[model samples]
Target chain A: GAGVSQTPSNKVTEKGKYVELRCDPISGHTALYWYRQSLGQGPEFLIYFQGTGAADDSGLPNDRFFAVRPEGSVSTLKIQRTERGDSAVYLCASSPDRVNEQFFGPGTRLTVL
Target chain B: AQSVTQLDSHVSVSEGTPVLLRCNYSSSYSPSLFWYVQHPNKGLQLLLKYTSAATLVKGINGFEAEFKKSETSFHLTKPSAHMSDAAEYFCVVRLERGGNQFYFGTGTSLTVIP
Candidate 1:
C-alpha cells in the first residue's frame, strides 16, 4: 500500500512570494497532520486536520500560514509572503484515527531565496 | 505542558556491540511515547510505540524500548549495532488531551562503525 505522499519534493521561491505545498494522506485516513523540520532540530507541529475541518491550527506560526483539506483526503498548506524563516522541510503525516501512530511522507523542502 | 528530552545528541557504537539511546519525558497526563528513525533525505519511520499496554515494547529492526513510569523514561536499545542502524532517531511524546498534540525531542544521531 502507498504511504503518505507529498508533491514537489523541492520548492525554491523568493522571500516575498507565495507558495502552496500539497499532501496526500493514506487511503481512508481520517486524520492528517503537518509539521516543519528545521536543520538539526526535530519536527514541529504546524497544523492538523480531521476529515474536512482543521481540528487544530494552533501550531501555525502566524496568520500568513493557512491550510485546507476540502475533500478530506488531499491537503494544501498555503504560506503568504514567505520569509527566510519559513525555509525548512515541510513534513506531512496521516493516521487512521486520532491519537494513533501516523505514517509520514518524504516531505517537501521549501527554500526561500 | 508536555516535553521530551533526548539525553545524547549523538551516539557512536561499533558493529556487534550494544546500542542505547536515552530519552526522558514530562507530561501532565498519561501520554503515549514513540520512537522514530530518519535516514538522510527520508521520511520518519516508526520504530516502536508505548500505549500503556506493556512496559517492554519491541519494534522493527531488532529495536526495543522499556517504558518506565517511575523514571519517566523510554529509552531505545538494541542488542547489536549494525551499519544500517546509523541514522537520526527522534523521541516523541503525544498528549491525548487537547487535540492530541505531539512534542518531539532534539533527536540523537547514531553512528554504527564497522
Candidate 2:
C-alpha cells in the first residue's frame, strides 16, 4: 500500500462482544504500531511490532487486548469482551524501521455500546 | 520516560497575524521533538522535527519550531497565520535512547479568524 491502511473505518459493537481491527502497513515497512485515542486526548500507545514479533506489548491495557503481525506486513488488533469505555479511535502506523518516522492511517472509530 | 505538555489548550489569531503554540517536554535523555497537525476527521501530519540537527527547524505550510534546551521547550511558530492553519496541533517527545516510543501532549486547538 502507498500508506498505512485500516479496515472498517467505523466499527459499532455491543458490550461483551469481540472485535478485530486490521491494519495494512506500507510495502516493505518492518515496524508497525497501534494506538488508541479518546475524545479530547492524544493517541495512547497500545503495542509495537518488529517484523513478525511483538517487541513491545507493554502498552496493551489488559489481557482483553491483543495484536498480531503474522507476516511483518498486515496486523490485527483483537479486543475481547469489549466494554463501553473502549469507544475511541484505533490508529495504526508503520515505519521503515523501528527507529524511523511513522506514517499513520485514517484510523478506525470503534464504538462499544 | 518522556512526556509533553501543551501549555495552551486553545489559541486564536487573525489572518496574517503571528502565531505561537507553547510546548514543554520532560525526558530522561536528549529528546527528539516533533509537531504534528490534525485537520478535522484526518490523520496526523508531521509538521516538523528536531533530531539534534538544528535548534531552529522549519516545516511545511510556513511553520517552524525552535528547540530551547534551557527552557525545555519546543514551541511552534508562524510569522503569518492563514485560515488554512486552523486545526489541532500536538507536541511530541521521544527519548533519545529508549524503546523508540513517542509521547504526545493532549493537543492545542488553533482558530484562525479571517
Candidate 3:
C-alpha cells in the first residue's frame, strides 16, 4: 500500500551548491528517518522525526545538513554548500511506530562534483 | 553505543547450496535485531526481525535468522541458495532507548552462481 518513496532518483550538482531531497512516508507512519549510504557501505543514520517535530538529529554529520517534516507526512532533507564528500545515496525510511521495523525508500542518489 | 558487525564482506555460493551470512552486534540494552536485503536499484527490504519474541525468525523468500544472545550474534541462513538471492545484506541493531535509532553494519554482498 504505497511504501516509502523518495523523489529525484538521481541528482548531480557542483560543490558549494544546495540540494534538497524529498521523501513521502507510508500512510499512518508516525516515525520517519533519514540515512546516508556511501559507496560499498551501509546506511548511516542522519535524523529521525516523530510526527512533525524531529525527535533526534544527532546523527546529522554537520550543521550544513538539516531536515524537516512539516504536517507529519512529507519530509525534506536539505544540504547547504554541498561537498564532494556528500556524494552518496540518501535513504528515507518510515515505520508505524518507533518499535516496529522500518520500510525504506529507493533512495535519492546525490553526486557533488 | 549500539553497533552491528557483519562478519563477511562478500559471500559466494553455487545455486542449490546452503547459504549463511554472519552478523554480531553490541548494545547496552536489550536490542531489536533485523536483517535487510538490498537488490540493485531497489529499496532495502526487511528479511526478518528479532524483537525478543523467539530465537528463530523466518522471513520472506525462504530466508531465516537466529538470534543468539549468549554469542551476541544473529546469523542469516537459507537451506538452498537461489540465484535471486544475490544481493547486499545488512544487519541492523536498534536500541530500545535513545530514540530507537537503528545502527547498521557494513553490508555483505552475496553472489549466487548457477
**Pairs that clash in candidate 3:** none
Each model's iRMS = 0.7, 1.0, 0.6
Ranking by lDDT: 3, 1, 2
**TM-score-based ranking:** 1, 3, 2
Q: Candidate 2, residues B34-83: lDDT per residue as tens digits?
A: 89999999999889999888899999999999999999999999999999
Evaluation by lDDT, superior candidate among 1 and 3 = 3
Q: What DockQ does each candidate score versus the true complex, computed on alpha carbons? A: 0.86, 0.69, 0.91
| Higher-scoring candidate on DockQ, 1 or 3 | 3
**Which residue runs does candidate 3 get wrong by more than 4 Å?**
none
Tell me the tens digit of each residue's lDDT in model 1 across B14-80. 9999999999999878989999999998899999999889999999999999999999999999999
Best by lDDT: 3
| Interface quality of candidate 2 as DockQ | 0.69
- Model 1: which residue pairs collide? none
1 versus 2: better TM-score goes to? 1
lDDT of each: 0.95, 0.92, 0.96
RMSD values, in order shown: 0.8, 1.2, 0.9
